[model samples]
Every structure is written in structure tokens, then in C-alpha cells.
Target: SRYPNDLARYPNARITFEHNQGIRERRKMRVNGNLLSSYQRQTVCLLGGVLQSEVSGMSLKLESPDKQVVQVIMKKPIEEPLEGLLEVVGEVTAKLAVVCHGYVLFPPGMSQNFDMETYNRLVELMNERKEHYPTMASC
Candidate 1:
């Protein structure tokens, strides 16, 4: 992309802090070198556990331990359906599911980012407490 006409150019003048320190460059590097390759596929990771607690609109990423791409969300996409999520646990063959507010549970091995153990545990905990029927939705 060419520089916008609105940007003023001064010969031998220092650019703003963004250009001087290469913050954008570094951020791009971090995204490409570390997060973009595997886990997140260069996208942001969103954790289910974090989304479950909110009562309002929000956005977050669920990143792996190694900066792998996982999941990204600009806002809470759906409502969490808290059901007998624990009953499914211990069933290794049982498909892993992702529950979102205003959404339904999604089978595992489908989503790029999420922690199995943590998510499962959280499901079990939330299932025990949630009473309202969540609207069916998917990842």
C-alpha cells in the first residue's frame, strides 16, 4: 500500500514512535515467527473458560504455551449452554466439544486453539451450575 496523501513527509525527519522503534514490525514478526505457524494459524486464540464468565460483550484470544495460533474473537459470539458436560468426561472416545454462549457444543479436533483438560474441567464445573437451556450454536 502506498502512503496516504494525508501523511506529511519531511526529508531527514524522524518518523513517529511506531516507525522509529519498529513496533509494528516487531509485532508482525512475533505473529509470523511464533504464533502464525501452527496453533493459531497466525490468528488469535480464544479460551472457552474466559468467555464463560462474562455477562457482557467482550473479545479475547486463547493462545497455547508456545505462541501457536489458536482462536480469535472480536466479541462474544454466542451464549454458553451449560448442560451435563461432565457426563461426557472420561469418555476418551467421546468427542471433545466447545461450548459458547448462544451456541452449541462443538466436537474436538475441529477447533485450532483450546486446552483439553482445562476446558473439560470448566465444562464440568459450569454444567453443574448452569440452569438455562443454551441456544444451539457451533464453532
Candidate 2:
């Protein structure tokens, strides 16, 4: 029953199973190959928990592969009320991918809006915490 050798004589079944299976196999191979290539190129960075605020957006720490630590704090001013604050934060976090090896990776049409002062304070804070995580290279 599983083999369905009897259906092999039908042209429609052959087209549905054989031709489609070939396409599916090719697609799977392409997907697996792409995944392998991406794994080889990209370094895995540890994204820490996000600390949210009402005035500003959200603040989260990213530990790069090189052991450097930097906080990816958002610099958006809250113009609207807290109606869709969560949605806004979600959108930002989804699009924002910080590369811990040393920098942030912005998607196409996206630009940096980082708060330098906050980053400086974060650097100081990270330095203070370095006493606990001696292995980490915090900025």
C-alpha cells in the first residue's frame, strides 16, 4: 500500500509524486546548503534580557563572540501615549540585530539611533560588573 506500485502506471500520479518529489528534494537541498553557509559566516552573539522604559524605548545587552559586551539601547523619543508601546518595541527589537563581534547590523533602509550618553553609562556599568564576570570583555 505504501509503495502504491499500481498507481505508477497513471500519468497524473507519476507527475504528482515523482516530479513534485524531485522539486521538493532540490528545494530541501538548497535550504540546507544555505543554512550551512549562513552558520559558517555569522557568529553567535548572546542577546540579554530587555529592560523597557516609558520615555525611551528598550535597553538590552549583547555579548559578542569576541567577549565584548555592549548594551543595545534604543534612542526613540516617546511622542505617542503608551497605547501601542509593546507593538513598537516588538517591531524595533525584531528589526534590530546587534553584532557582538563589535557593531550593530541594521537592515536595509534602517539607520542608527543610538544614545551615546546612555552607551557611555552602560560601558561604565559593564566595567563595574566585570569584577563578577572576569572572563567577559565588557565595553
Candidate 3:
């Protein structure tokens, strides 16, 4: 299911568990072709992890095959938070193909806010429709 040959310019765009998870949430309709993104109806779908506060340099930009841009900007990159984000994306890719990848679009250091209640609520919202996942066993 991995389209390794896709040449879409995506910085921090990794089709890892993070990106795949998001893909899972999309709705698969065998239409004649892909949908078009109009300039007025622009929305950036996010499917990636968050960065830690200490790390600098973060960004993510996705251009559609037709050149429509969808970007998700974040600060730093945190593994656990990203793990959580991808899990949510995976659970919902069936209906939303827009959620492509995740990245940071800020300068210097920015707060992760993983501990913030508001952010946690958003994560919860994403994972709300998500299927429960069992923790992987360590070898």
C-alpha cells in the first residue's frame, strides 16, 4: 500500500506508520479520478507527530498532483505525540485523503504544548473516532 515512487514534494513527509495511519482514515471511493482542490476551499490535512521543544527547524509542505498546497506547521518534533497523531490518522484515512504529512513551519524553538489541556483535547478529538489499538509487545 506504500506508494514509494510518489514524487510529491513533501518535507518531513514520511509514509511511516504516522502517515499510513492517517491514510487509513480516508474513505476509498472508486471514482473516475482524483478530486480537485479549489483555491477557495483550501484546508491542510495533518498526519504526523509533534516535536520536542528543544529541537529547532520544523516544517511540512504538501503539493497535490495539480499543485494545490496543503501544509501543517508545528514546533519541534516529539515521537510519542507523533505516534499518537499517526494512530489517529490511521483510524480515519478512509474518508479523508487530505491528511497527508506532518511538519513544523516556525523559526527557532517553539513550545510543543503536549502537556497543555487544549492540545490534549484536540488529540482526543482526532482519536475519538479512532479504533482502540493495543500496545505493541517489546521483544
Pick by TM-score: 1 or 2, better one: 1
Candidates by lDDT, descending order: 3, 2, 1
Per-residue lDDT tens digits for candidate 3, residues 1-139, read 2332331332333333343353344432211002322111232233233322223333333332222233333333434323222211111122223332332332112223333345334434433433452221110
Residue 81 displacement (Å), model 2: 37
- What's the TM-score of every candidate structure? 0.21, 0.20, 0.24
- The digit string of per-residue lDDT tens for model 1 on 35-77 reads 2333222211122322232334332223323333333222233
Model 3 scores worst on lDDT over the 10 consecutive residues at 30-39
- Per-residue alpha-carbon lDDT of model 2 for 17-136, expressed as tens digits? 222233222211111111223323232223222233334534434432223333444443333322110101111122233212221122212112333345445544544564553322
Over the full model, what C-alpha lDDT does candidate 2 score relative to the true structure?
0.27
Among these predicted structures, which one has the highest lDDT? 3
Candidate 3, position 48, lDDT: 30
TM-score leaderboard ranking: 3, 1, 2
TM-score, structure 3 vs. true: 0.24
